[model samples]
Target: MFQVYLIDDEIWALISLEKLIPWKEYGFCICGKSNSAKKAWDDICKNPPDVVITDIRMPGMTGLELLKRLHDSKMKTQVVLVSGFAEFQYAQEAIKHGAFEYLLKQVKREQLKECMIRLFTFLSEQKKKMLETEAYSEKQFWTQMQDQQIKRAAECLFQIEKQEWIGKVCFVASCKKENIVDKKNGKMIQVESFRLFLLGERDENAYGLCIADQEKSSKSEEIKKFLAQVSEQETVWGISRIGDGTQKVSEMIWEAQTALRAAYFSQNQILSYHIKGNGWKKWDELSRAMYYKQNTQVRMQLEALKNEVEVGAVLSDELFSILERIDYEYKKSHGKNLKPQEWIRECDMIHSYPSDKEFFRWLMVFFPVQSEVGSDSAQYIIHLIENQLANAPTLATIGKELGMSQGALTQILKRQTGKNYSELLLEQRMKRAKELLVYTNKTITEIAEETGYTDLFYFSKTFKKNNGISPNEYRKEKRIENEQSTNEK
Candidate 1:
């Protein structure tokens, strides 16, 4: 039921309104009645009602002044103005001040009831819209945090100013499809397949911001019982340390994810940051080994890292960073080019794995060694071509260098790398051109010449055909991405 407050300077007017209006039948309860606007204002501040009805003219503080105060306070209260005078200016002012309705002093019961119904409907719709917008903003904020777009995430949080969310501990729970109840003041936000819960205060197991001292122990027991009721076979949770402010939301989320990964690895029902260890140093070592193509060292480091996780170490974002570095190194080492979309799909596949061991196994195949005869032969031929790339070696020059006929070399290349000599040469040249475009501020003509292409137009055509974007367009996109990344940092 909605609460309503009535205020007027005239005692008779207040009594008449209370006696005549069937507030209870219309889904409203008279919360407070005051003869002075000042008293009403004080009472509203103490306990704001859902709707307020007041006479326009009052001593000390007029109804307009009270409306302005309520608007400034940002309370979700609907206001209706009742006045003795039916002047156009008074009604216009009431509307300007956001009054729900302006009614004449001697209003008929039927007219008053109709206005009340309309106001109730309007409030209901407004409440729904506000909730939807808040939910959307909350979801967007968390997405931005995950993407490392800190500024954008902060802006989203600022828009949805929930003071309780500040300085709260964040928790993330991954579970099969099941309904989770909000027993505390904490709120649950759905993110893809996970539910993120922000706990402002904790009493043992109870997760909420508002709890009386006397009820703390009972609340904690209640929360523990609730968690015990959940099926451990299908649920895992990660809890973050207390957050400082909105700015630290991203950091807190990362911590929560780290804890969650640890829980998954250890097969625990719940994990907290206390169990998190420094695993990024090992991740960095693994990345460097992969970059230098130290196969033995990479394998050793990966095995050690896996052992560490099995014991208790939590996985960090550096895990994904290592995968990205491996992808870059794989392309550079093998002379294979993959589109960004393909790279993203590979990352998503890795992220879907439930444990570190499974992810490592996938990575082994993802960056396979060139041990097969076909792959080794392809790499050898590519190496020979790269050694004399400036000469723009033709099929005959390449075959002669390798002591084979052009026909034999063409068939071998096609069978191994799925591309003939001419296609491979073009692809190599385009890849070099792209590197020059991104790593060096060289003119298109100079880059084309460096890549063994004398004709700029032909070079551009081949680049566009191979990469689906022209050289200049690719450079511009890379620069924009770099700038955005810098700003995010």
Candidate 2:
């Protein structure tokens, strides 16, 4: 949101401007307000806001002087002057010198709104052209140059495939489960310790390429694992082991990719790569199956190769294929592509399966015995909450686990499911409590503990408040209902 700083000599004008517009709806935020222009300058210069509003005839420093001062000081804040009829010509002259626009005294909301729209739109265009966002994947790690002339110069300087980084250990890492906000206005793509590069394959937010100092490669992997554990995201590190200093960049990348491939097969977030010379037999077939959009063929190939490697590789591949088909069909029907990443977070759970059979079972869960396609059934955030419920999961704890703050976590939950953290947690707990009440002989205390509450009295109170009955009464009522239905049948 664009930040706006307000300055006016009259107190009423300041108050009216604050209430004149719902600023946020127009993508503007009122950052600071001052009745004195001289006093406001000291505050504004501390951190220049995107836009400044000032009364043309102020007590000491006039709005025209402030506007010229802003330009002289090299601050890029756009200034809008509020003026009376007498100062109309003066305001227009200030605009020629660089004021954004002049607003008449007693500014109407719609009039002010129209001026802001023009100001914001102009500023946005400038910012966009100046800074473009970047996301990195391993495949295109080396070729992210923006200017075609500069890229051609670099191409002449170094061979694309054979460029050498002799002493660096090239690696690719994944943070699939991390609740990362892919950095925006991204002149600097934030991937924990890794820097950003444009990725040609895989979700860029979930993966990054980093080159470690060869001597500290061992320590790097350990530190990376520790960080991933804290975030509860399985991080795969495909290390292109300490080869001779002459290894070409392409060779190291291939080795690192091979290591990552092996890690995926092991159902690991791919923490470390092991050099493997014996490649899989059906790799070509699996790749082809995925390419041809043959979901069954991909699944069959995966099952055949399931016992040969880790379940992670198969499921990840299977998920890509399924998403490919979904995106393809959606495009055919709706005339647009729903990018594969939309369906990917649902399958990030692929790291959990321990056996080949889990592949079929998991597929059944999503695609099931239905003639038509189902809408998105993946509860990505809810699943994370459910997994940690017994541990007395709080929003802060969950946020920490995902490398996000409590507020960021809340926003994500609200955006995805139209619910807040407390509501979602309450629903999960009550649903679990109900299942226990109807299906198990556990006491209320045991159920309370299982549902993440240690205080039985508090749990009982909450259950009654939400369900309109105490635990025992709910359990007895369910049992009576079951018996009556059975007898009536």
lDDT (tens digit, per residue) of candidate 2 on 393-480: 5778655544567887677667767888789888999999999999999989879977888799999999999999999999999999
Candidate 1 — which residues are off by over 4 angstroms?
Answer: 72-75, 148-489
lDDT (Cα, tens digit) per residue for candidate 1, span 381-407: 675455445555677865554456889
In model 1, which residue pairs have backbone atoms overlapping below 3 Å?
A: none
Worst 10 residues of 1 by lDDT: 203-212
Question: What's the TM-score of every candidate structure?
Answer: 0.33, 0.38
Range of the 10 consecutive residues with the lowest summed lDDT in candidate 2: 365-374
User: What is the lDDT of every predicted structure here?
Assistant: 0.63, 0.61
